[model samples]
Target chain A: MGGEYLANLADSLVTVMDKMAGLTCEWSEKAPQLPAITEGVTVVSLLGFTGAEKGRVVMEMDIETAQKIGEALNQEELGPFDKMIFYALSELSNIFCGAAITQINNGPRRPGLRLTPPNILVGEGLEIFGERAHLETASVFWEGGLIYIHLSLEGGAAL
Target chain B: MIREHLQVFAKASSDVFASLGVQAVHQAPLAPPDSFFSRYDLAIIVGLARDLRGSVVYSMDTETALALAGQMMGGMSLPGLDEMVKSAVCELGNMCAGSSVCNLPGLTADITPPTLITGSKLAIMAGSDNVLMTEIATSFGTVEVRLGLEE
Candidate 1:
C-alpha cells in the first residue's frame, strides 16, 4: 500500500473514532516509537483483512487512553482493564477497519477488501510483527495522549 | 457431543507440541470454567464460525509463552516477547484451532486469525458462558485451553 492509501485509512480511522467514541483525534507527522514497559498497560487490537486484499490493521494505545475513550463511548467511568473496555476497543478497531476498507474499495484499483472481526490484545510490554508484509504507521494525538495505528499489507502489493 | 469436541482440541494441542519437538501430556478430563484462573499473563484467542460458532482461547504466563516461542524457533533464547516471538505464539494457537476443526467428523468451520493478549489480571470473555477448559503439561510449562461454544 502506498502512503496515500495509508493516509486515507488513517483519516477514516480518526473520523470513526470521533464519531463513535466521541473522541477527537488528529494525525501526527511523527511516527510511533517502541512503547516502553514503564508506560503501564498497553492494548493492541488487530483486525485482519482477506478476500480481495490481504492485510492487517493494528491500533495501539495505553490503558489510560483506552479507558478515557471507552468512558466516552460507554458514558460511564470504567475500571482498569475492564472487559467492557476491551470490547469497546475491539469494536473501535472493527469499525475503523471496516470504513478504511470501504475507502480502499472506492479507489481506482479496488482490491475488494473484506475485514475480519477485531482481535483484542492487552499487555504491559509488546511487539507486533506480520510475516511477508509491508507496514505503514501513523501516530495520532487524542485527548492529550498519543496513539499509533499501523496498516500492514501482505505480499508487498499495492492496493 | 461437547466432550467429543473438546477431545479434538486436546489431540491437536498434543500433536502441535510434538511437531514442534516438545512433549505435551494431556491432563485427561477437562477443567470447569470457574476453575480457570486469571493468573495467566498471556492469551491467544481464535474465533470459530460456520458449523461451530464460538472461540478457543489458549492461556499461559510469560514463562510458558517464552518457552513455547523458543521451542517453536528451534530453542532460540528469547530476551522478551518480541514481534517474532509473538507471531510464533499466535501461529501456534492458529494451528491448534485449525487442526482441531479438521478432526471433527461431518463438521466444517472457519477460524479467525489468532489474537495475542498479554497483561496482568487478564480474562477472556467468549460468546458463550459455558466453557470447557483443559490443561496441557508441556516440558516448558503448563497451558490452559478453553473452549466456548454457543448453544
Candidate 2:
C-alpha cells in the first residue's frame, strides 16, 4: 500500500469520527506515545480487510474515552465498560473501517477491498502482531484524549 | 439439519485444535445455558449469514484462554491476555468458523469477523432458541461451543 493510500485512510477515519461522534479529531503531527495499560482500562477493536490489500486496522482508546464518545453519539450517559459502550465502539470502528477502505479504493486503481465485521478486545496490556509487515499508525487528539488508529498492511499491492 | 451442521462444526473444531498441536475431543452435547453471564470470562462470537443466519459463540474462562493462546504461540508464556494472545484466539475462532462453512456442503453463507468479549458475569441474549450446544475437552481446558441458528 502506498503512503498516499494510508494518508487517505487516516483522513477518512477522522472524518467519520467527527461526523458520527461529534468529536474533533485530526492526524497528530508527531507520533504520540501509546497509553500504558496502567494508565487506565483500554479497549481495542480490530477489523481485518482482504482483497487488493490484506491487513488489519486497530482502534485503541481508554474505556473512559470510549464511554464519552458513546455517550455523545447516543446522547445518554453510559456505564463504564458497559456492553452498550462496547457495541457502540464496535459500530464506530466498523464505519471507520468501511469509510477508510472506500477512500483507499476511490481512485482508478480499485483495490476491491472488503472488510470483515469488527472484533473488539476490552482489556489492558494488549499487543498485536504485525512486526514483519508494513505498519502505519495515526494518533489523533480528541477532547483532551488520544485515539490511536493503526493500519498494518501485509504483503499486498494496490491492483 | 441441526445434527448435520453440528457434525461439520465439531469436525472443524477438532481440526483447528489439532493444527495447533492441541488434542480436542468432542464431548456430549449439553443443554443451553440460561445465562451466559457468570458462565465464562472470555467469549468469541462469529456471525454467519446466508443459508444459516446466526452466530457461533466459543466460550471459555480466562485460564483456558491463556492456555489456549500460549499453545497457539508455540508454548510461549503469557502473563496476561495481551494483543498478541487475543489476536491468536480470534484467528482460531475465525479458522474454525471458516472450516465449518467450507465443510458444510450446500450451505451457502458468509462468515463475519470474529468478535471477542472479555469480562466477568456477562450476559448475552441469543437471537433465537434453536441452538446446538456442545462441550469439547482439550488438554488445556474445556471449551463450550454454542451454535445459534435463526429459523
Candidate 3:
C-alpha cells in the first residue's frame, strides 16, 4: 500500500473521529505500528481487511483505560471488555471503515478501498499479519490516557 | 439525558445516512415492535466529546450487520462482520455523528475503540444510581441502550 493511501486512511480515521465521534484523538502517522508482545498479551480489537487494498487495523488499549471509557459509556454495571463491550468497539470500527470508504470513494485519486467488520480478540499472544507489509499507525491518547492504534495492511490490491 | 441524546442522535444518524444512499428507518412494519433478531442481537455504542458531543453509536450483532454490509457490498454474502466490516460500520456511525455534531453546540467530538462484541449476556456497567433503558426498535433489530445523565 502506498504511504499516501495509508495516510489518507489514517487521516480519514482522525477526521471521522473528530467530526463524528466527539473524540479528541490525535492521529500521528509519524509513529510505527506497536508490536504485539508475546509474553503478556492484552485485549485486542481485530477488524477485517478489504478494499482496492488489503490489510487490517488492530487496536490495543490498556484494560484500565478501557474501563475508564467504559465507565462513561456503559449503561449497566459490569466490568470492562465484557462480551457486550465489543458492541462499543464494533460500532467504532464500523463507522471508521465507513468513513474510510467515503474518503477513498471521494478522493481525487482512486485507491479502491474495501473493509470488513471488526472483531475484538480477548485472547493473548503476539498475532501479526502480512510479513512483507509496511506498517503505519497512530498513537491515540485522550487526557493522558493511552489507546494504541495499529494498522496492518498486507499484500493485494482488491477485496 | 443520554436517552434523549440517543433519540436525537438516532434521528440525526438516520437523516444523514439517508443522504448517503442509506435509508435508516425505525423497526416498525419492516421488523416490528419485537423481531426475532432481537433475541440474538447485541448493541454497543460509544460517544466522543471534543468540539461537540459525538453521536452515540449502537453496534449490533454481525448477523444483523452483515445484512446491512451485504447491501453496502451490493449483494455478496460474507462469513460475518469481520475486521474490515466492523470498522466500516463503526465508521458509518462516525459519519452520522459528523453529519450533525455541529447542531449540538459547545462540544467537538470523535470516536475511538471499535471494540467488537460477539457473545450474549452483555452486562453493561451502570455506575449511576438511576439508569434508564430505552428500548429503541429499529429496522435492523431492537436497540437497547442504558441512559444515565444528571440534569
Candidate 4:
C-alpha cells in the first residue's frame, strides 16, 4: 500500500468530517484494530469503488456516537435514533467515501474510480469479515467518539 | 427494470449452483418484507458499480452458509464459520453478483469484494428501500438473495 494513497484517504476523511459535520476528527497513529464493542449498538456503513482499481471503504462507530454526529450534521436534536438519523449517517458515509475516492482519482494513480451507494448496517455484537485482500485499517477520533475505517484493495487493474 | 434484474440474478444463481453440482430452485421473494432486520444469521454483501449500481446481499442461516461453502470446497463437511469458511462464502457471493451483472445485457458493471456480516438482530439498509429479494431452496437449505439497485 502506498503511503500517499493512505494519506489521501486520511486527509479526505478528516476534511470531510470537519467540513460536513462540523466535527474535528483526525486519523490516529495507533495500529489499526477493529474495536471490541461487546455491548451496545454498532453502526457500520460501507461503500465500494470500481474502475482502474477496485476497493471498498467501511466506516464503523457506536450508535450513540453516530446519533451525536447525526445531530451535528442535521443541526438539530434528534429524537431517539430514527430514520432521519440513519439517513444522516448513511449520507455521511457516502460523503466520506466519495471524498476519499475523489482524492485517489485525482492523485497520481488516476484510477477513475466510481462509487456505489452506501450500505448501512445497524446491529449489536456484529462481526464483519473480508479476507484474502490487502487491508489497511485506521481509526478516526473526534470530541464525540471514535470510528474505524477499513480499506481493502482487491485484485484489479494495477494501481 | 427491477423485475428484469431480479430474473437475471435468479438465473445466474441457478447457473452458479448447478456448476457447483448442487440443485438450487429459485422461488418468489420471501413475502411481508420485514424491512431491514434479517432473519438469517449470515449475510454476504457485494456492492455493484457502473451501469447497475447498488448492492446484492446473500443472506442465509449458519447451516446454509456452511453447506454452501462446503460445496464450494469440494463437498467438505464444514464445522463452523471459520476463516476459510467465511472466505468461501464471500467468494460465492462474488461469483453470484459478478455473474448476474455480466448477464445484464447491454449493461456493464463491476462488483466490489463481498463483505460478510454475522451476528444476532441484524438490520441492513442497502442504498434504498426498493429492494428485490428472492429465495433459492437448495438441498442444504434456503438462501435469500436481495438486490438493492439504485434507480
Candidate 5:
C-alpha cells in the first residue's frame, strides 16, 4: 500500500464521521500509547478487501466509545452497550470502508476492490495479531474517544 | 446451498490439517435456532467476498492453539502462545480459508487475510440468520468452524 492510499483512507474516515455522525475526527500525529492491560471491553470491527490488491481494515474502539458513536449515527439515545449498538458499529464499518475503497479505486492504481461484510468482536483485553504487508495504523480522536484504524495489504509485493 | 458451502469449508479445513499431519475429524453441522453467539479464548477470522460473501471464524481454546502451532512448527512442543505460535496459527487459518474457496468448484471468490483475536472472553456474532457451524476434533483439541454467508 502506498502513503497516498493511506491518506485517502484517513480522509474518507474524517469525511464519513462528519457526514454520518455529525462528529469531527482528526488523525493523531503521534501514535497514542495504550496501556498493557486496558480496563474496559474493546469492540473491534474486522473487514476485508479484495481485487487487484488484497487487504484488510480493522476499526478498534472501547465499547463505550462504540456505544456513543453508534448512538450518534442512529440519532437515538441507546442505553448501555447492546445488540443495537453492535449493529450500528457494523454498519458504520461498512459505510466507512465502502467509501474509502471507492476513493482508492477511483484514484491511481485503482484496485477495483470489493468488500466482505464486517464482523464485530467484543471482549475484554482483546489483542489482534497476524502477519501483515505494509501495515499502517492511524489513531483518530473524536468527541466520543480515541479509535484506531489498521490497514494492511497482502500478497507477493507486500512480502 | 449454504449448508453445502459450509460443508465445503469444513472439508477444506480438515484437508488442510491433514496436509499438516494432523488428523482432524469434522462433525456434522449444528442444528440452529436462528442466530448464535459463541465465545472462545482464541479465534481466527477471515472474510470471504465475491461469489462467497460473508465470514468464517475458526475458534479454539489457547491450549488447542498451542498444540496446533507446535505441530505446525515441525512437531516441537510450544511452551506458550508466543508470537511465533500465533503467527503459525494465523497462517493455518489463511491456508484453510484459501483451500475452502478452491474446494467450492466454479465459484469465483476471495478470502481476506486472517485476523487472530485473543482475549480473556471473545464473543463472535455470526451476523447471519442462516448460520452453519461444525466442530473438528484432533489430538490437539477441537477447533470450531462457524460460517455466516450471505444468501
Candidate 6:
C-alpha cells in the first residue's frame, strides 16, 4: 500500500510540474537514460516531514532539458530551465511539499504531519545509495503521451 | 511571522549546500503536493511549532556527503562512511536550524536526533505534500530533498 501510494504521489507530482512548468511532462515505464553527465543541468528540491514518519522529498532534473519547459507563469513562457536550474528546482520543491503538507495536515487518516522547505542537492558525480526501484515506469504525459525512466525515488527512507 | 522565519532558515540551508556546490530549493519549487514523506538521507530535522510554526531538515546522500567531508579535510579521498561525513551532515542540520532561530521572526528551537538511512531499503510513510519533491536530473541518478509544514 505504501509503495503504491508513493507511485501515485509521483504521478500527481508529474501533473503539478507539467501544469506549472509546462515541460510536456510525463512519466515512463521505460528506464530514463542516465547520460555520462547529468546534462550539465539538474534541478533538485525536497521537503521535510516531521513527526512519526520522517524523511524528505527530492526532485532532480537536467538543466538544459529543464530550460526546454516553457510553462507560462504570468502570460510569459520561459525558455529552457537549464539556466534557472537552481531557481526552478527549489521553487518546484516548495510547491510539491506545500501541497503534501496541506493534505497531511488535513487528512484524518494520516498521523502527525509537518513539513519544511526543500533542501536542494547540487553537484556532479553523485552516487546512488541503493537499488533503483521504479527504474522503469508507465508515465502519463500532459500531451497524453507516454514516457519511461531509469528510476524515480519518489519518497523513500533508508532502513 | 513563522513563515518569514522559515524562509530565512530555508535560505540558510541553500547557502550551506551551495558551499558544497549543491542546491537547496525552498517553498517555491513544489516538493510534491500529493506525496507522503519528504525524503532525505542522513538528516537532522527539527520543528519550531511553539513560538514559531515551521520546521527544517538538513540533508546529504552517501557520495556527496563523503565528498563534502573530504573537501573539509583538504582533498582527502573518502573511501567510505567516516566521522567527517557524519559530523558534516549533522552540523549542516544544526547550523540551518540554529541560524533560523536567530534569523527568523519569532521563535527558538531545540535540536533533534539525526537519523541516518542507508542501503537500498527506504521507508516512505504514506504522505502527500502541497508541492511534490523537486526532481533533479543530473549526470548521476536523481537526488531530491524536501521540508514541509502542516499549517
What's model 6's overall lDDT?
0.44
Tens digits of per-residue lDDT for model 2, B66-107: 888899888987888777787788888888889998998887
Could you tally the backbone clashes for each prediction?
Answer: 1, 4, 68, 0, 0, 103
- Which regions of candidate 5 deviate over 4 angstroms? A33-39, A155-159, B32-37, B127-130
Q: In model 2, how many backbone clashes occur?
A: 4
Please write out the lDDT profile of model 6 over residues A78-111, one tens digit for every residue.
Answer: 6643334445545665675566556655666564
RMSD to true structure for each model, in Å? 4.2, 5.4, 12.5, 2.3, 2.4, 11.9
DockQ of 6: 0.08
Task: Provide DockQ values for all models, in the order shown.
Answer: 0.25, 0.17, 0.03, 0.82, 0.77, 0.08
Tens-digit per-residue lDDT, B1-151, candidate 3 = 4544545555666665455444566432211112112233344433342332222335455565665555556646768646566655555544555554545445444433322344333233221223344443445554443322223
Candidate with maximal DockQ? 4
Indicate which candidate wins on TM-score. Answer: 4
Error (Å) of candidate 3 at residue B33 is: 28
Expressed as tens digits, the lDDT of each residue in A31-55 for candidate 3 is 5455553224355555444434555
Candidate 4, which CAPRI tier?
Answer: high
Estimate the TM-score of every prediction. Answer: 0.74, 0.69, 0.44, 0.92, 0.91, 0.46
lDDT measured at residue B48 in model 2 versus the true structure, 0 to 100? 69
Give the candidates in order of TM-score, highest first: 4, 5, 1, 2, 6, 3
Which regions of candidate 4 are displaced past 4 Å?
A35-39, A155-159, B30-32
Worst 10 residues of 6 chain B by lDDT: B119-128
lDDT tens per residue, model 5, B71-132? 88899998887778888999999999999998897898888888888887667765454567
Candidate 2 global TM-score = 0.69
For each candidate, give the interface RMSD after superposing the true interface residues on Cα. Answer: 4.0, 6.2, 10.8, 0.9, 1.2, 10.1
